[model samples]
Target: MKKIFKLSLPMLVIISNVSVGISQVNVDDRQSVENAKIVGQLHGLEGDTLTLSYWVNALGLDETSSYKRAFAPVEQKIIVAKDGSFSVRIPVYKKLQYFSLKSNRQKTIWKEEYFFRKGKMDDISTSASVPVLNWSYFILEPGDDIKVVLQHGQMSFSGTGAEKIKYLNEFKYSQNRPKSFQSFRGDSLSTIKRISYYDDLQQFGINILKKYHGRISPMAYQVLQADIIGHCQYYRYSSASLFNSYKDPTIRRIYLNIYKEQVKAKALPLLEQLSTEVLGLSKSYPLFWQQRFKVEQSYLLYNAHGDGVETQQASKNDLFEAVLNLKKGLLKDKLIVMNCSDMLKVFGQVQVEERLATALTELQDPTMYAVVKRFRDDFSKGQLTYDFTMEDVEGNHVRLSDFRGKVVFVDIWFTGCGGCVSVAKAMRDKVEPHFEGKDDVVFLSISIDKDKRMWKNSITKDAKRDPKLSYQRPGAHYSGDKTIYLRTLNGSDDPFIKKYVTNAYPTLMLIDREGKVFAFSAQRPDGGKAKLLIDQINDVRKL
Candidate 1:
């Protein structure tokens, strides 16, 4: 079935511990080991280097189309021996946590989530042949241990809690198989049919859970039940795929024209049913409030678009009324902030800033009000660009502030991103030639490719290419003139890139000479708006 209630788990690498000549811990003997922390050992790794990254979910700001919510993740990374036989202790939080094991040479990554109670040690062993290594068999006792055996494309788990883990894994595997829900097309499925399919799927999930209730933890069963119910409500009230397809204006308009009347007819009754269901569910569920707000926001956006009310055309009062109509609480406060942030992106910083200033007075939750204010203050124009030091192709360290007195156009990209590569080619052809000899303008290309070798290889290949485009220069890489500053993130997460909220690859930015941000998100070099870079440079010079 289509994944119901997808979890937002951001992978954050924390630390790396490499050990040699370390003795592997036997799973049978781990029961006697102190259960102070979670310890893991991997067996048959193919590569010389293995990376373990741990991620913890934190309540921070998450922005979607300029709307901020409360969800962020902190990650830490650790490197282990490639022999796949190293042991390390990981600190455990009170809540659930997630980690990943990545083989650099094999190009394989295994990710899994687990709950680590105090004084618990998790012993894991897997080989290169293991189809899955993460969370396959986890012994949950304070000091319990488990072993996973993978051979000939088959996997088996053994340990104190093996039965429970095996049952859970089998149930999850069955649920993940391709189902009819995956083929349900948004445009083809009627609203009633869509609702019916989701309801049927939800009932199926509940039945499965009931069948296996005695075999799983009560907490796990409750969480899964809540997730199933929330997903059903979300899909029934708001067409899942239809909401996502709104990114393309043409598709959005077409779907609206075809389904507007039907949606108008059925939306209220569906929403009413959803509201009643959400109100009946306890507040302890993770998706309880989130689901309600999601349905409400989706409904509002659906009606607004159908009525041809563009965000720009909608006044601040209109936005306020939309938010005010929602039930007052944390959800309403968050929705208000989200609406204001959306306005900020649509109506420019000044207008949205004023709107938020007015909203703070009416907002009940001080934390959300502070979050909105902080977003406004941080994203305002003229703020100093976040500085970062990255390694260039020649191994020279380049700091963003080094070009403080020159207008810098930064192209944030990676090696595998096709869009990023296309934009880079366009910049090299049409944009770079415009200021070939102008020392006041610098074109900076920063690659966030985690693989340093791949980054270097791509740069070397690009340097050799002499595209015969209209703006082709004598050499693609300036024949060693170093006109374009090429840098790599070098596997570390650069704060400078994150400061601009670069969720998309090939994010272009224009920084003014005074080390302040001119445009946090600029036009693509391949588009007609690419000329705006030059205009922005001229405008900054005049300032």
Candidate 2:
């Protein structure tokens, strides 16, 4: 499943701690050593490294870049000894937290292959080593010491909580079998095929969990079950978007009937199992919690549309109203916390403050209210945005603060992003003409590409204009003086890129005349939001 909540787990590869002798606990970790420990032995893995990571926040509401800084995952790496033995102590949590292990040898084929529009070849066109994580997950909590044994990538467990961990691993291995579904053609057949694929996938996962029912703790089993259901439900919800593009009357009617009969019918019973009382289990699987809310909200909206309800009490996508449909408990309160970002993005500050005020009145549990309040106060309009300095094409140092008195439109992107190129085309063709000679505004494009030669070549023209290379890319279109483009000093390793711009590319931000943020996520210059972006620029200038 595509990850909806981009957990800001640090992927920054730490230098191998080869010298940090195994089983050595620091004085400060004496208490944690008593509480939590993992002792493991490995074979055929003496040269590789192992990384252990676990979430600090259980509810997965750490959505913003700032929140992630405060509650990032606690990750530690240990290099295997020649004897194939290693030991490490990790921080403990009160709840049954989900912990995962990954190896330095693990990697995915590069996602940037053939990013150039034309199927082309070059030193850069071949696959690069990207760290796409495939984690082996297990449950960990306070007062647990587990010993693990691994031989040639096969792992077994013993000591406290061994059965639970063993069962979790077994379930993971079962689900890793190769599966495929019909490719999306944005038609009725594609939609039906997707729904059937997820249905079978969810059932397959549930059967695996059932096989180990008594062997695993009830809490662990419940969480795993919710995860299986949530994953399938999230896909069902995402598939609803297909109706937006292909709106044939006859096809849509048949699609809605199949959806109501099969999709909705299957999801309701599964969703019921994830009630408010089980909110504590949510922390161990934050993605499950996040997907649960999305699934619930989509169910309500689609139900209303299917019934042909002309008059609704609330707006179509109003999450607050959807939350009200749930029982009064911690689940309701936490979902409200998760909805704060969506409100801020869609309705802006005034509505967010008003909603939070109203939410406070109804909140039965305030554990996450602080997060909502902090997000509201910190990202409020007019906050001075982070200042960055980088080298332009001429190697001249330029700082964001230098353009303090101008309205700055910032685009954060990298070499292989297609959306960035499309947005650049839209900006060049549509938005730039209006601000052609405006001195009060600036267009800044920052790239996270690592190779300076590749960066330079991308921005400059191919003298040959090989018809094969005639495709319009962000670098080519953004190369001109009309746009001031700069590349990050160390590519993805740059601190600014790591800390602020996590994951999403083609991110657009609007900075006001005082170098304060007007919009953290501004609209793209596409057909739908181009006029609004133009108006936003004009409006920010007036301030």
Candidate 3:
């Protein structure tokens, strides 16, 4: 456990590191001055049952994949031990919700909002308090229960800015949840002793009449849809910014035997077609369509991580319409798919109105739809509407709609883009002073090059030739919520250069808090990948 960020004036010196005895109960007085607490031990990582399909890749939360789930008021649980050993807990509670609790307690799927409290016992040296910004606290209340062991580290990494995240502050541990250590799964077709568990529920079309449409029942949507496409990315590094582990046990048994033979033949006709025609969870998909299935199965990572022998030039219906367009979070078509969280919320409201025909008519779809809305308005909404407006160095008009209820990145670039202003000044002198001024988040920036006064006098007289900077949080921009961010950038006509006609300049876009849009990139955000976007804005401020 290690997190730190500095920039004190009125506030912003985050500094997170704990473990060596932990404690925190925090009922939430707006998060009791935040009450920082860090403790590790996925218990004794490594699989045997409660790997419970590794809880959406260990709470980084992914119905698709924008990434988040580091560790927050966590309260996770698991049981088994006559002497076998395995009883985990993490109490801090009062965050939104998350839990693979091991994928609904390894398919026991009860979820009264996280469970396990028979007579609540303890003694794995009892004491678990997790509450960092990103997700990992596993919140467990309602009849609360505590007791854990199964620990973790060998350095479960993350770090950023002032340059030494110490590789994300090495609070290290590991017995095995590196996604269970031995299971290579890029997208899944089958694994776990000869496949058959609903074969990724009809490649996530989840049919049996649309698997009970959101209220969930066709037996809890065939057990959380075969625990999210046959157990969420085989486990570990579920994103909340950056954590990518691969360890190869033949590539985690070929991604758990092609996600256990596509969740035993497309998880009950895609949960009966989203329990017959989308009632809830609408018609979406992705927890990671591997960046659009590596651009149409870039030959399955070049035929198993590189060209060894075969290369028939892609066919088997183009690899089953590229694994059904990476389970519908992509594929402009062989039959259509696109849902990656509604194309990252209409491509972040069509790049705040640089209107690629209203962001391809709000990402509706028409096959190569304006070539996928000019490739998501020139790669993720032109570095997030590069300079729709600006003025910083503290004069502060700033305005990405004043950050609108939090979570905003905007982040375009060009100090001549190479190491892009030293990775944007090491993400603004180390992760924007560990989430500056202590609001939910706001990392601003936008300079496509019209010359905001030579980039505001090169960010106040060459702060080392513009090392990059942008941030927002405090009363979060401004949000009466017509979907904020300047009402999604007012909507067109110079609307951020009529959909990127100015062309790409280190784009970064990421927006949320009602403004929609969550990710887009022109490149260079890696101060250890802003520790997975500061653990997905500390897991959306714990939902």
Candidate 4:
């Protein structure tokens, strides 16, 4: 069985099992940590010196363990008391919280995360209200109280009124129309559309769009029209609405294009449009939270793929240039907080490389310092490559180099790797059928230990024989020797692995065939939302 570290613990109990130096893993099946209200005191213990400090979980449980703290950025957070005597509680039906650890001192440790799960209210020993937390195990000596709360604790999910699905229509009236265009002005309408994607009232500004596209895609594409101010009120609102789905690039492009056009078209309102659209994109895709858990669990084995603190901080410098250039607040923080990935990947591509040099001039950029720390490494010398290759069960001779012109999903696995097998099986059931004929991409699994006979035997035991997944990797390798495709190369032969070394089993490396370096790597290939993978593949198609 695969060990799922990043999961909702439906086995609720607010069970904060301590493992001396390891982190606390909170399990929840439904809701976020914000839903599980908490009020607590954080402490630190080194040699029996107990010190109380300010902390916050004012909204949820503080599940950060020693290992968990390594994966998250270091800021203020509720610390379990030193000496390991901390009050821990979990309210029934509460929202789970997710966060990683960081430090102001040493380099950022990437694989530490805290995910709290929900359980029944009557099952726990504490009162329903938030409880006081005083933990002791590791040594943390500061308070981490949040300055303000962004969300509140919900008493129930099945309640009526504001909590009910019916309450969405109320947001329909909150739209602030672009400054110049009159809603009724037919001459100002450049394009009209109806989208099925919008069904929420919280993004009420889009009500105008739905009203316009009464037919056609009124089902998927909610109405969003650009006005003189270049701001598509509906687009701005929809980006923040939880109803927004991740698969739609046509929509993300519309927002991106609108931002570009407004700036090019000249505007007293360009900043306003860019502000709404740019920050909105981050809200739509919270990349920071997306990989937090994986890093928390496997940082030493995986790559977090970004600069250190300063680099992380400077990257968000231009997110909402118009608004952030003028002022700083939640908008700025949200832009920097949520979009740490795009700042390095997609946005990095669009930027001038020298801008990185300029960002380094700031003296506080953690990226340059990080680069200096690894300056002798392969990435600095431009020697990095995704050099490893593997054959599929069909004996297709699929190498990472073979997919050089397109995007490649490189599954680094062995026959006995349960997580790897589970993900491949999942792809067959949950996703592969959805894209039955997509030939634009290729998926390959590379075995580290070279054993062709063992490989074939394992394939027979797995693909042809598994019952729980009901997945048969039908076709090649099974019919004859020609049916099985297997490639094996030790990490020693692969320069890519040598550059950024790793030892984790069943690692997933998403690579670009064009450049052939690793795009993203994960240990739990199928655990969380597949949006990150979906987004990368979609991005390639757009190119």
**Which one is best on TM-score?**
2
**50-146 in candidate 3: lDDT tens per residue?**
3211121122233233221111112333333345344433222221112322322221111111111232322222233321112221222222332
Q: After superposition, how far is residue 71 of candidate 2 from its true place, in Å?
A: 7.2
RMSD to the hidden true structure, all candidates = 12.4, 8.2, 20.4, 19.8
TM match of model 1 to true structure: 0.54
Model 4, which residues run further than 4 Å from truth? 1-398, 461-486, 491-493, 500-503, 516-518, 522-525
Candidate 1 overall lDDT versus native: 0.48
lDDT of 2 by residue, 189-257 (tens): 556666777777777877777888787667666776766676566666456544433446565556566
C-alpha positional error of residue 5 in candidate 1 after TM-score superposition, expressed in Å? 32
TM-score of 4: 0.29
User: Per-residue CA lDDT of candidate 4, range 1-543, in tens?
Assistant: 322223332222333332211012232233333222232322222122222211111101123311121112212232344442333232322111222222111222122211212311111222232122112111111121221111232111121111211112222212342112111111111211111112122234345444434332211121122121112333323232211222254543343343334312332332234443233222122222222221222222212332122322232343424223423332333322222223332333224233333322322212112322231232221233545454565665455565567655655555555566676655554444444467666655455546555555555523454343323242212212212234564432344443332334455555554644444343232555455556655665555
Q: Regarding TM-score, does 1 or 2 come out ahead?
A: 2
Ranking according to lDDT, highest score first: 2, 1, 3, 4
Pairwise lDDT winner, candidates 1 and 3: 1
TM-score on alpha carbons, each prediction = 0.54, 0.74, 0.28, 0.29
What global local distance difference test value does model 2 have? 0.59
- State how far residue 512 of model 1 sits from its true place (Å): 2.3
Clashes of each: 12, 1, 127, 54
